[model samples]
Target chain A: MILLEEVWRTFQVGEAEVGALKGISLAIRRGDHVALVGPSGSGKSTLLHILGCLDRPTRGRYLFEERDTGSLSELERSALRQSRIGFVFQFFHLLSRLTAAGNVELPMMFAGVAPEERRTRAQEALRSVGLAHRAKHRPDQLSGGERQRVAIARAVVMGPSLLLADEPTGNLDRASSREVMELLERMNADGLTLVVVTHDPDIARRARRVIRLSDGTMEEEAP
Target chain B: MRAPDLLRFAAGALSGHRLRTLLSVAGVGVGVAAVVSLTALGEGARQYVVNEFTSLGSNLLIVMPGRVETTGSIPFGGVTHDLTLEDFQALVGRIYLIRSAAPLAVGSETLRHGDLGRTIPILGTTASYAEVRHLEMASGSFLPRRDPEEAGNEIVLGTKVARELFGGENPLGKLVRMGVWRFRVVGVAAPKGRSLLGFDMDDAAFVPVRTVMQAFDRRTLFRILLEVRSRGEMEQAKREVVRLLAERHHTQDVTVITQDAVLSAFSAILNALTLALAGIAAISLAVAGVGIMNVMLVSVSERRAEVGLLKALGATDGQVLAAFLAEASLLTGAGGLAGLGAGLAAVKILTAVYPAFPASPPAWAVGASLAVSVLVGLTFGLWPAYRATRLDPVNALMRR
Candidate 1:
């Protein structure tokens, strides 16, 4: 469902050009659980952003579900992001003012879903994440693990084909992180393509396959 | 995506910062209120002038010494001849439509009664002048139906003059002195609060025209007042008088203006003044627009992360820009309505306190103020909304 061909992302800070991702090529099949593990400055976050369609590679070809994402317009790319891809961040970026259900409905809102259907779908997503009882609670009122679950519900509310998570458990305690990983693993088993970026090797060991990156290059594959 | 949903979203965003939204609304409200109230005042003064003119009889025509087109009363550097008593005699003597004619001669003099003295305006006219102007007599009679040149030696005191000179006593047969001439007061005029010809009638004394002309040593009358028999015959009377004066004087030097012409001209000048005042007040609205711009800029800057989140959630650039723009117009639109209500209420309160002055906002001013307020929001909010749309989602999401 995802493919990258010599994807290179570069940035110019002042006058010198710096490369964040250098000539990286990788492909993951549908319904596969892939973990990207690397140290800081290893381009793991950049790769996750590219996979989520939040940022475009400076010089590379990206194919999302057999369609050329690099050739899509900004408007088309935004449509692709909402309909085909979902993202879960480390900080669980839920609007603090909205209730859990409202946070879950954000993506569908931008998709022009009707109010009644959006509400129903948001409630269903919260129930799937075991947060139906906390649907009316705001982000500040919810615990950290609950907030992450709400964010996950928001991510999957649009029923995206692929889920990209960048450091999903970076800000969680050990027990909360294990619960979040189990929830994500359960979704992956139910046939949702999952790509997770993590610093902890223990988390990566649970995935079907682990791809490790060093500097800006893919260094090794642990089978 | 939909307009209603966009509006809802914008409203939600504004609700996050309650104090800032309220302050912005207040800023625009004050501006709209200024526009509304100032125009009301201008309109009130205009209505006041119109009321005063209509109070004077509409069937009357004024023949002044100068042309209406001329700026000054003494046109041609004081070389133009004045209207005389002979012209007054000729008009009433010939024109059958003329109900009555009163020749006026005016001067400022001191009136002395026993040991007390007060300087006041003296209006010199025949008995017909009272009937022409509808002057009511509180005591005795006005000027006593005598010929213009006979010098009746009779005087009528205005209510104010009578009160100041005679106190509670009847001033009917009392004698008053004006510049070495002794005159007996024949009547006391009633209180007529409206002023005519730029002087208060209540603060004046009435005497025979020829008596004043002879005492003041003047050969010309200041003006002549001719009251037509009916309002329908006014135009014919005007033409007949103009032709007669042209035949007698061999040229038309005097300006004959019907009361309608004077009233319309007064109306036009006052309308222009009202528009000018509205323009001055509109400047304050512009300042309020700047205030809106400042608030919108701050709002955009403060919501960068939220903007990024919206984009990542699949919101198009147009949708985000429209959301911010909606927020701005909503503030100004609501403020404009509130200010309109406040200003009209203030005008009502003013009219209640002083019933003499009628203040009301014109429809054009009301519509223009509302339209300009919305336009102000769109114009001032454009830059901020554009800035919001241009934010890079990746960089914005990285911020706290």
Candidate 2:
């Protein structure tokens, strides 16, 4: 479970101050699939980043599993992100030098998992994402869909409880986007909390709940 | 984190940019070669001088009346009116520590044979000069002690001087005019190569000291060369010589030096020169270090994205730093080894080509070169590695 109370995030662009998220309150229970929908510069990514513990809110209390995240040090935050959360980016930011299996094994490596277990886990994760055949192929050698699948496998390899995906299908075609969405829905069905940020109405409609934002303010929550 | 893995990684990275790595490594190689070759040249010269001095024999003492400067232009104070033939006689006849004493008197005189004439050195010594100075007779006999007592105008020519005067014919029993005196040729000494002063000892003619004194009308003695029994007795022998000479000449300002003492002083000077040359050569190593730093900075800039990916994959800043440092150290270390091998091979080639002068690379030179290379790696590597480690993961990830 994740909770944010009166989260106010601000940024400094040269001489002026800008508020990306203005006093937003939200909570999502464990196993819930949520979609954050907003226009460009509407603070959805900022909210997601805060939830992922990648950035701290300028003024707010963020609680993950009933523990306050604001009190954690940078190293503790990194460890929390490493062990408890997984991320999938819109651009499919897979490491260029690593093969599909290598990218999937990266999170487990950081967690200090045993080498044998890491390989087995990476293989299983790749299989789950339907990328087992492309395990030995580097990102440059794989198709865009396969590359996204490899990124997904890397994101979920650590078995994190929360999956934060930012426009996972933004760069994919309709067929690949459908396949990626099905993969995320299946993982959500397995009881992992999935929070996806996107501008597509069709993708937002598929989630169990949708939170809409407008100009740094939460507009409404719809089921 | 393991050494082999680090090495593999460095090898791969270096090979990825072959031209850059080679240029940097070549910089270090040239630096090392410069250091080794220049220092070896200096060492070779020093060795040549030491060998030249050693060939003159050891544990002997030279008694001169005045203070003699070992190097530079000859000073006027070296001339003294203290030493005489009586001092040499006293040491040979009275001093218990004396082994053998040879009274030496030297002057430049012109010798002529028919139309050919040349200025030749005339060394006047007794019959014991052959034994004390290790001179061997090449063809004719040496003058006897009785010859000097009888004031016989007899002389011995060196191998080169004999050839110059008599040509292909035998110079034994041939008469040559030396400074208005027709001296009989009693012997021809064996050919000895150039001395440390660059004077050819084989080009000089030797005659009895009494004959020179009587012929040249010279009363002042220049020096007395003494052969001691052993090096351990040099101090005792010198003290006795000084005491006997001071009593006869009635002057305490006399110079008596053992051969080993002179050699030690020469060694000290040569050691200082070697160090100075090595120090100058070390500057090249510093320049090579700057080359490494420059190349590494470029490498870090080119591999920004790769570095970002590594960091995102859980590599700590320290690991990134260590990786770059390892690359630099490996390059410099390899350069040092290659330079050392090249320098030793050069020494071998030189020795083979000129057997008279053999150069040996000292152990300290090798050790110092290795140390200098490592220091260069560290000094030049730190800044670039620090820059790579401090790059922002977000910004780096965003870089194409």
Candidate 3:
């Protein structure tokens, strides 16, 4: 579970100050399938970055499992991200040189897993996503749907409690998008908390909870 | 990370762009080759000079007339007519450190042994020339004391000259023509090979000093070769020779030089040559560094999204830095190894083509070249690696 109180994020473009996220308060519970939906420049990406621990709010108290993430050092924050969080992107950003299995094994490598154990886990992760036969293929060798499956397997390989996907099906066709959405739904049903950021109403309709944003402010939360 | 895993990753990454990596590595290879080749040349020339000086004997000294100029022309055409028999006698009798003194008068003349003839070098000296020069006899004897006094028409053939004229047969007591003078071969000197000046030491004929003076009509003294008791007394012996020569010649223009002085002068010349070569090699290294930097900057720009992806996936800033550093080092290290191989191959080729010239690469040159390659890698890689590590994950991921 995670909590944010009075979160504020500001940026400076040349000489003028701009607020990307202002006074946002939210809570994410275990096993909850949540969707944050907003239009372009509505601060949805900024909120996702904060939730992923890739960025810190300028003014906020962020708690991850009762530990004050706001007070954590940079190294501790990196360790937290490595151990308890997984991220997926719309572009399916995988290492060009690495195969699907190699991309999945990256998180285990960061955690100092033994090579044999990392290999077994990576293979199992690929198989769970119906990509076992494509384990040795690089991202460029895979189709759009297969690349997103590989990305999902990479995200869940570390057995993280929280999965944050930013536009998980943004770049796929309708059928491939449905397949990727079904994969996320299956994982959420298997007790992994999922948070998705999207602008599609049909995609947001599947989540158990929906949080809508407008102009850096949370406008509605529905369950 | 474990070294094996790091190496595996590096291999995978580098192999992904084989042509680019090889080209970068080749740049480094050329740098190392320049360093090794130039240093080897310096070492070879140094050895040649040292060998030449050692061949003249360690305790030997040469007393020349007139001062040696550093960078200016000599008005008297050097010390050709300065040294004389009187100066040689004064040093031998007055200098306590002198073991023996041999006055040498040298010239070139055509030699004939029966039907075979060739133009060879001729040295005219006393019987003491053998003792002063440490000359060994292969067969027969050297000129006797009475030979110089009686102006004996006898000659000692060098090993090569003897081999050329008589093949395997003995030439002692045989008559040979030396500039119209028919002289009997008294003895065959041992083989001395060629000196560093490219002159054949074993291709000369030696006759008594009196015979050369009377028959060849040679009167001007060339060089006075002095053999001292030991190397420790060389400085004292040279001082005494200079003093005696200065007093006899009634001027201080004469020079007394020891083997150590000659060695130092040779080392100085080698030092200058080494410096010049090292400077040129340094420019090659700089160019190699620039090539590496250029390639790495391009790589960083192209891999911006990958860098962000890694950072988002939990790679620390240090890990990103180390990855780039490792890539650069691997490239340059390969280059260093290639350069070393190429340089050694060159040395081998030169040795096979010209056995008389020394062309061996020394251990120091190899070590220095390797060290320089690593340094170049670190220096050129730091900037690009820093640029990559400082990239914001948000901006980098959003880059097209």
TM-score of each: 0.86, 0.80, 0.80
Candidate 1 residue-wise lDDT, B1-400, digit = tens = 6677777777877888899888888888888888898899999999998887766777888888755564465545434567888889999899999888899999889998988787888889998988788888898989978788777678898899999999998888889999789999999988886455776888899999888888888888888999999989989998998888877777676878788887888899999999899999899889989999999999888888888878877888988888899999988887899889888988999999999998899888889899999899888988899999999887777675
User: B82-169, model 3: which lDDT tens digit per residue?
Assistant: 6656666667778888887777767788889778997887877777778877788999988876533346788998998999998888
Candidate 1 vs 2: which has more lDDT? 1
Q: Write the per-residue lDDT of candidate 2 for residues A1-223, one digit (tens) a residue.
A: 8999999999999999899999999889999999999998899988887887766799989999888999987667667777778788787777665678877876676566776887899999999998888899989998878888888888877778899898888888999999999999999999989999998899999998999988889965647
**CA shift at B247, candidate 3, in angstroms?**
16
Candidate 2 lDDT, B309-387, residue by residue in tens? 5555455566678889988888888778777777777878888898888467677888889888977887799899899
What is model 3's DockQ versus the real complex?
0.44
Candidate 1 docking: what grade?
Answer: medium
Per-residue error for B144 in candidate 2, Å, reads 7.0
Estimate the lDDT of model 3.
Answer: 0.82
Per-residue lDDT of B346 in model 3: 83
Cα misplacement distance, residue A198 of candidate 1 (Å):
1.7
> Which pairs of residues collide in model 3?
none
The CAPRI-style docking tier of model 3 reads acceptable
Candidate 3 Cα outliers beyond 4 Å, as residue runs: B63-124, B127-151, B155-206, B210-256
